[model samples]
Target: MYNSDTTSWQEVLAAFKRIWGYDDFRPPQGEIIRSLLEKHDALIVMPTGGGKSICFQLPALLQNGLTLVISPLVALMENQVQELRDRKLPAALLHSELPTWERKKNLQNLEKLRLLYLSPETLLSAPVWEKLCQPQLEINGLILDEAHCLVQWGETFRPAYRRLGAVRPALLKSKPAGTKIAIAAFTATADPKARATIQKVLQLQKPAAFQISPYRQNLHLKVQTIWTPRGRRQGMLKFIQARPHEAGLVYVRTRRDSEELTELLRQKGYATAAYHAGLSPEERRQIEASWLGGKMPFVVCTCAFGMGINKPDVRWVIHYHSPLLLSEYVQEVGRAGRDGKPAEALTLVSEATGWLNPEDKQRREFFAGKMRSQYQEAQAIASKLPTQGEVATVAKQFRDGAIALSLLHSAGQLEWQSPFHYIRHQSGKSCSFGELNAQQQQFQTQMTQYLTTRECRWQFLLQAFGFAKEAAGWRCGHCDNCN
Candidate 1:
């Protein structure tokens, strides 16, 4: 175990240069890393290109015990773990896709790891959770990578995320005394509301915060209105044609859209592919490798495409359809111009109304309907929920009962005692379809407002992300409306 308390900044730089061959830390990187080494909780938000990973990774290596990184994506975990292992760093990742032998081996070696990456689900799985609860595991910190996912998906499909705030406390309860477990949430995109939610949900204890503005001078933003679906196709094609062989990503809302658009582009003699969660892990990796390797110019994909990808020279990003949230828009577009060169983010929209092209509105309606149905399902099962029980046991007895409990927990109608155990209140607080759908409605409205706003695109994004001071009376003079 390294003596982090007496470690000098010079030694930190030596390790950085020796391992990653870097000489300096980005602005707040040094501060964030210092906070982690000192065992202080922190919330870090740097833009996509800002060396965010080094801030935690290096500190984890300098620490005494294992630093558990809770990430949202399997591909991201695998990519990061592979990179560390390639450097001969004592890092490992555990995911469901691992073969039995590999998984068993990882479990056996958990105590020896310096840094371990796993999804929130994997972290809470019985095998991993039991091992973590062991008094001798000697955990030092918890790192939440791509933390915006906790706020974005915690209340929705990925209920496992909602249970994370309890993780540190619950594990500490069974661990040996004097085990200090600090937590840090790291993300490239998070708004003021999202930040507040993360702080509250994680029970962060006066965490040291570092937030950089999402504004990028080199990334030009644009939004075009198209009256027809074919016009939408044409707009994207024109943008790609203008770029002429530059690496980029075309963002879509669904898997079907990814495939359909990829097919259309490929028919036009473009070297492109569809990327979405529907593809097998091997298939996804192949596409990711091809794109990153520059064999494929660009790929049409859903929001799942860009978390751990370190492609620094992505020249452009086009949104075939507007995302439901501004944070998502910022994250996707932020993927471009990472090399500090000029990049362009173009968004194509249907008319202000859905008269000629109805995809955007249809998607909103579809998503809203689904949210309402989910709320009703949870509402129906609320009364039948037990006061306290294992989440998995309830899942076996009732369909979607685990998810319902999750949603109830989100609404203050129930509580998760631990990732595996939950407790529902007998009476008092009640949840509603309307109450649960409120946040989604707000997100839908914000995206629509962004699509139709006549203001500078960069300014709108900056202001949307709680950078009002930086955005004050500022204009890039290059965005669609600015021009």
Candidate 2:
């Protein structure tokens, strides 16, 4: 009943009103939707709460074909799919944790779906890929939500993401003639480098690019230096006590920190929970539900707590420890003040020198050390990788082989042949050392600058994120520095 022809704008409005109880689209959202409906490729870089989901979801609902959204986190996919199903919309998700019968049922109903959300790894799995490539399946588009993960994790951690560039072409080979699969990538925080990487990797064709600056005027930012670990605990407790009824999140860098902070908060008579990747999916779900449902006022979580979880009225976010990357900081803080109300973000760090507590510096060095070791492993395996083969078999054949292969791909010595295969360059050279290390150090330096800068917090962020014109003489009077 919905179509994207010239007159489809009216249809879009009608659907929006009927389904979402809304009257309009955000800036560039209508334009982005129009482009995708016309089978045009697009790259969208709007920040969080900019209605990024609606831009893709609405178009998918209006089309006859299916839109595959490759997202990073399981929680994210489930949250979105559940929301759509509540609206009686045709959206479903597939992930590792789904029950066998449910997975089978979803697959059997694939053709009935307007949107299907999955991880890049799940998308390229044998059964999933086989079904999607069926000559009868009509995939209208491939979208990368949280597209920055393709840069953040694809290179070293999750190699399947590195092969996504080859997905569209492979799917089209089995599709009927006159079928055009428009490709689009959506992300909340992609720097110029990340944007270029996403475009180059996904091979988007002259996409309609929509970029919104990563500046949130509603979020008040501040950084507090604590001289001792005990002081850090006190600061956290104090921050929580001051906002007794407000819901918020405390971002930490480790699982242990998440749990310890959770205990500290609980002992202070606050309802809180710990969240990290190590928890069972069910446990994670309960915690997510508690916080989202307002049974818990806050959560102490690692980076795993992000992507696809939506709560508009979060009044604050405190970085229990400094993030090692500025992009990460922006993303976590963007989660707050999404309802257009005032929100606070307080980042706690150690004193200028590491004498009192070198925890932050120690963490940065440890992270760098891990990257350096991965580089060494990749270099050792580059000349030894099979000329061409499936990544799963390679992973079984050698230790950390998949990770090594991904590192080599990111270093330019290897290229993806398909979603599950690769071709090593016969240049007779191993992956050169220090490239990944150097990149890691550069990111660390940028994050350090953000933490130590004397400029207005938002101004520093705007300038760092490539909106120099807007950052020029821009200062929010509410930031800690200004106050």
Candidate 3:
């Protein structure tokens, strides 16, 4: 390992310039890179243009073996891998989009590479884990990208992520003795609880958590209340007209909202595009590229558009509707002002829909029902596992039991009898009148304050998430209420 402190900032600069030809580090980048080199577990909360990638990528280059990056988005992994390879850095990604031959070849090349990115979903697969654990491939470090998702915001019951704790132990068991693996978890949004969850879920050992304030002095946050849907359209138009030709993002609550707003903005003479999960992958990428490349001055999108997005110089970010949670609100707005220049965040809030968007509401219901059914099926399967061979019995019984328990526990439909045992839904524990409702109501109250309060949005958010606020009250000055 390089003696990080003994290595002057000049040596780091020369090495970076020699490889990527950069003369200096972005603000905070040097501190983070130094932390990584010193073998400390770091929790990095860097906004879009805070130079997050270089913080990790540079360390990967300086390190001896492969750095395993656990990314959630397929496109994100592909983009990073391509960029690294372009820089002549040895990098590869294992994702579902890869063909069989390519995936196998990438796995074979793991020993020769400096970085390997894999989605948590792919890493959770038993077959993939088996192959990766074979004597040849030993990970030197682990990076969890979009690390906040390991908590409930991105994963309400993401089974794959829950399994990662066990996977880490399994990985450690297979690696050679004296192998010291460093893990760093990075995200754009993580409140105190989410940060804790990320550390626990990733099984980090006394991780050093570093959080840059989400407040950007360059971005203004505004919330305007509209009484009707028709009023929202007029509000959006007015907001867009206020600043023409500057790049911006408009976030809507639904896919249909994205399509309609895109058309509305175009009719108003602004170059625009719509993006959401409902669109085909190709279509989404095209829209994203258009917006990022400055071909379109604005993009009407769902919350899915901003994760790991590197587009800088976004002049504004407008939320056409309210988000369900405060964490999400922080993430969407953080996308702007990432270039360290002034930007704006305008949220057009209407009277709450009571969560009535058919698609959003139905998807939650559908997933809940599916989890219940899967739980029952897995329970039956586990009961039938024979007490015979160690590997087969343990795999069949332990996995099924773990899955059944985690799903039910997360869904709030089961009460723990012991660590290994659980009982069925009691009245208070069921969905109708349970802990779930209590938590949902609490978050709703937080959202209400977010939209209605006269206080600075940054201060409001920090308090809502149980973070310590600065003594000056508002840390950053560019938010709507501050201005």
Q: Which candidate, 2 or 3, has the higher lDDT?
A: 2
Tens digits of lDDT, candidate 1, 326-393: 88998999999999999999998888779888877888889888888888887787677667888888
What RMSD does each model have against the real structure?
Answer: 1.6, 1.8, 5.5
What TM-score fits each model? 0.97, 0.97, 0.82
Clashing pairs in 1: none
Candidate 2: residue 20 Cα off by (Å): 0.6
Judge candidate 1 at residue 224 and give its lDDT: 89
Order of candidate numbers by TM-score, starting with the best: 1, 2, 3
Model 2 pairs whose backbones collide? none
Off by over 4 Å in 1: 426-433
The collision pairs in model 3 are: 221-480
Model 3 alpha-carbon drift over 4 Å, by segment: 1-10, 153-157, 266-270, 352-433, 465-467, 475-478
